[model samples]
Target: MALRPAPVGTGIVFTRIDQGNALLPAAYDLVSETRLGTTLRNGDGVGLAAVEHLMAALWGCEIDNLFVDIDGPEVPAMDGSAAPFVFLMECAGVVEQGASRQAVRVCRSVEVIDGDKRIALTPADDFSVDLLIDFDNPMIARQSSCFHGGSFAFKTEISRARTFGFENEVAALHAAGFALGGSLENAVVVGEDRVLNEGGLRYDNEFVRHKTLDCVGDLYLAGAPLLAHVDAHCSGHGLNNAVLRALFASDRNWKLEPVMSALPSWSETAVAAEA
Candidate 1:
């Protein structure tokens, strides 16, 4: 996939180069599937999957507009984290747009509940995420984390956490036509009593940290950076999209407002993209 600078208001659009240049806007309403990963489809039924990592990187980089040119069905699951994407963006450099950035400020709390899983967005002065997860596996019984969003914080704290899966479920996922390219290099594989990766994990609570990364990416589907706090428990791609839908269901729930603060120092520099 190639990332190209876009004029203001272009938002983040995906061009399906293999499918007649179909345009898929990364918006919550267009989210068609959320089984294992989030998928967005255009009117012509062209869909793209696993976009959460790259989207999270874009949010971490404070990028407002870009065109993603991809010739595949999903974004490259590079090491199953947003770190690679963040590195590429830094190498390419980010440019501050002429206009102020807009944000979806949550005016009231909105939530989605499915059994014990729950996700919510509520008013906040700045973007942040508080998440919790639970599993019966001894390796990951329960983990919780809070992230105060910013470029440096995201890169150092959340971006390198790799997506994880269970060793026993690999065959079933494969049979279901998912994780076709997933492996130890791009995902953390949990065995009966231990992690199957060579070096163990990047963070002690890496699993929950990775979930926060996915949350940032999934929430970016609001078409802007959020000026709110996200609270999620036992949530996944499905509930993430559902919460966004619920947040926009009422005009009183949120307001689109311009961000008045100055751009962060990291984005102040302008650099040339390599050939």
Candidate 2:
């Protein structure tokens, strides 16, 4: 992973250097689909996958401007979590730019549901997330957690939460010619009341926490920091992308503002200003 300083107002863009110099703007219009993970496609056939977690880390850290150049179809699934990506960014050191930071303010509640899964964005002075997950497995019956955005605390609390899967599903994934790089080192595996992997879960509720991590990343596609309270239940990458698309589809639901150096506190101002 590499961090390159971006031009003012560039936002976070992913350029597929492998695909004939195509640029995919990290926005809702570029979202091609949500299959196993979030995917973005440019008109020139360049695309990126599994970008939500990295996006979340950048957004959560309040990095408003960046240019990401990747030479592959999918980003390196380093340890299958966001912690490594966070570490890389920390090592690179985030620098403050002369440009102002912009944010998307949610003015109303917007929600999307597919079957029993649902995700919602509500008005808030600051960005926050509440995530809930339910699995049939006994180890991960139901889990939930909340995060106040812009807090790097999430790096420790949730970033290391690993992607999980069942043993039966692994065979299917291989047959489909995916996860060639996946292994026990990168993913958590469970089988019928027992943890198949030698190492157990990093956290008791890692499943839900990973979902929260994904929410943070996918929501960043708004192309700006957002001030809203997000609540989600048993949602995946597809649903999260849908929620973003819904918010942007209606201009009445939200507004984008350029970053400002001076802003009133949430309690002091009737409406929070961009920063």
Task: Highest TM-score: give the candidate number.
Answer: 1
Model 1, span 1-275: residue lDDT tens: 98888877888888999999999988999999988889998888899999999989988888778889899999998899999999998989777766777888999999999999999898998989999999999899899999985879999999999999998898688888977765888999999999999999999999999999999999999998888989999999999999999999999999988878765542222222520
lDDT for model 1, on a 0 to 1 scale? 0.88
Give the alpha carbon lDDT tens digit for every residue of 1-275 in model 2.
Answer: 45577766777877777787688888867788787778888887678988887887776456666777788898777887888877777766666655556779998899999898999999987778898888898878988998774546777787888888887787778889966656677788777887777868888888888888888888889887788999899888888888888898889999976645463211111101111
Return the clash pairs for model 2, or none.
56-217, 101-259
On lDDT, the leading prediction is: 1
What TM-score fits each model? Answer: 0.94, 0.90
What's the number of clashes in each of the models?
A: 0, 2
- C-alpha local distance difference test of each model: 0.88, 0.77
Model 1 TM-score on a 0 to 1 scale? 0.94
Candidate 2, which ten residues in sequence have the lowest lDDT sum? 266-275
Q: In model 2, what lDDT does residue 194 have?
A: 75
